[model samples]
Target: MNTSPRILVVEDDRTVRTVVNDYLSGQGFSVTAVDNGSEVLARFAAERPALVVLDRMLPGLSGDEVCRALRATSDVPIIMLTALDAVPDRIAGLESGADDYLAKPFALKELKLRIEALLRRSRQAGAAPSEFGLGPFRVDPARRHIRRDGVPIPLTTREYELFLYLLNNPGRTISRDEILREVWQWQFGDPSTVTVHIRRLREKIEEDPRFPVHLKTEWGSGYRFDLRGGEG
Candidate 1:
């Protein structure tokens, strides 16, 4: 039998942690639970989970901080859990490198769906090739490495997958719903999550993230990956 997918849960709340852990395990996942941001990196290195459920408010290291730090080294998928409902707060989480987000007091079913969606995307992206180039960035999918102007730029697993998706479909506008389905494998659409990942991708790949030349926003639509160096 195949080993269950490993999941790392980084939340300070005991009740929330237990609920997620128990629920995911019952769904046939292997879970490692940890509290505080301080331990996330170490646990991640050791556990090498297939995905991470990280809380936005963490002791020692904030969820965003942890996500950013992890992005600097690895491409592990991270889904942030937070109580903040503000748009800015959601953006902040995405900008900090989270792959997806879930507001607190969320339904367990929703969380399960998100986890499964992320995992499916990861698996699909991994099974494909290891080399892709778009704009100024080049990615070796087999090695899971990305470089800009020949200088290595590290990306987490989710970031790499997002980048790959954009590269594979340049110039065409991809709706948030499509991104959710293709990148997150979410049948139930989540535009907020798509927005966050796109924002984070811009920060990593664009020389000027505030005015990106590659990842272009489509105003009322979603986003387009401009590979020809032209503004959308």
Candidate 2:
């Protein structure tokens, strides 16, 4: 069913583009190469690549603009590539919807590693669940729907993915690093993003988001979903 990961590479530099394309292709990914933001949306619609390698500076649509546009319509995993090394720039990229970021002049090996890690995380986060029961919440992964005692609950794409991850690994203390790696497709992430999303999910799924019983924080460790409340 074409399970191999698909990647879209958007870069204007011919040398970097060729290198990345060749390297990723060697790693057995179906790759679609493009040079500017003008063609990104069209190709994305046609190919629907599982992940994207987006350069921050593009000819037509700047990487930030492209990322914003794509996020409005899709939640495809994006790894932003940029030469800007400022902390604010990196934070801006993440805030703008990049799943990960890599500074330019990056080692090919490191880039490949990051791509592989992101792909793995994407697959795990999106893993289909026949049905998952967490306390009173029941989720159908295939349909991306959730219900509490038969009452439907609405969730955004990111919230749904985070909920599924917690449900799938009930009772396991998931570190921020683990959550970012598994759900966000990034080795490192802005911790605020994790906290913000968790808060949002708690609001939707928990009977009382203020004192969440299902999703609990573990002091300095991380967060976990305690289905049995550790009493059974």
Candidate 3:
């Protein structure tokens, strides 16, 4: 079996698909290019791509639908390709559960960097402490899971990484730049991406996301994960 990380590139544009496939393959990845979104899952099962490069628009199932479907099954990292670089569109893409997003006309070099970053995080060894819990929450890195009060809480790859990072450093305010550097391994990236994932994680762990108890925003300083949930 080829152990090289496989990448599933889902894009309808022939030129774009070819360029991405050639570039990524040249970068030492095993890439399988497929056009239609409808065939994504089948390719996913067969190719077992470590990451998915999904175009926002597709012929059959649509990229958002494919992304949702993939999230339902696996936490494999997904990078969305959007023609429009509007904030709302990127927000919608992340909300749909894409691990990352790249606007059209983006530099392939940047795309390569994003893929490398997410892959590095994903491939990190799972030898964290046997268990961790804050209040009703607990994480088993070996099992790749988190639980609240012994009940499992489903989290995507990025969310789990973010949560783990927060748990590893309790009480301190973590800035978006710091998070992007530490968690996402990005020297530079859009801060809103961190904001969106944090909000998503808060929804899963907090009693009230609007009045977040665990993941607290430190006004302009970024966010802090309060272990006590600010009860003290």
Instruction: Tell me, by lDDT, which candidate is best.
Output: 3
Task: Report the lDDT tens digits of candidate 1 across residue range 1-232.
Answer: 7599999999999999999999999999999999899998998998788999999999898999998888777777888898997888988888887877888889989888878877776676467685767667787766767788798867666777777788889899998888877877667754876777777777777888999988899888888888776854
Candidate 3 accuracy as TM-score: 0.90
For the record, the alpha-carbon RMSD of candidate 2 to the native fold, in angstroms, is 5.1
Tens digits of per-residue lDDT for model 3, 181-209:
99887789788889889988988888788
Query: Which residue segments of model 1 deviate by more than 4 Å?
Result: 130-139, 144-152, 187-190
lDDT of each: 0.83, 0.80, 0.88
In model 1, where is the ten-residue run with the lowest total lDDT? Answer: 121-130
lDDT of 2 by residue, 1-232 (tens): 8667889999999999999999888888888899999999999999999889999989989999999888878777788899987777776776667767788999988887778766664555466758767777788776677888899776545566788788889888898888887887667756766776677677777778888888899889899898754432
Worst 10 residues of 2 by lDDT: 117-126
lDDT against true structure, model 3: 0.88
Question: What order do you get sorting by lDDT, best first?
Answer: 3, 1, 2
List the candidates' TM-scores in order: 0.81, 0.67, 0.90
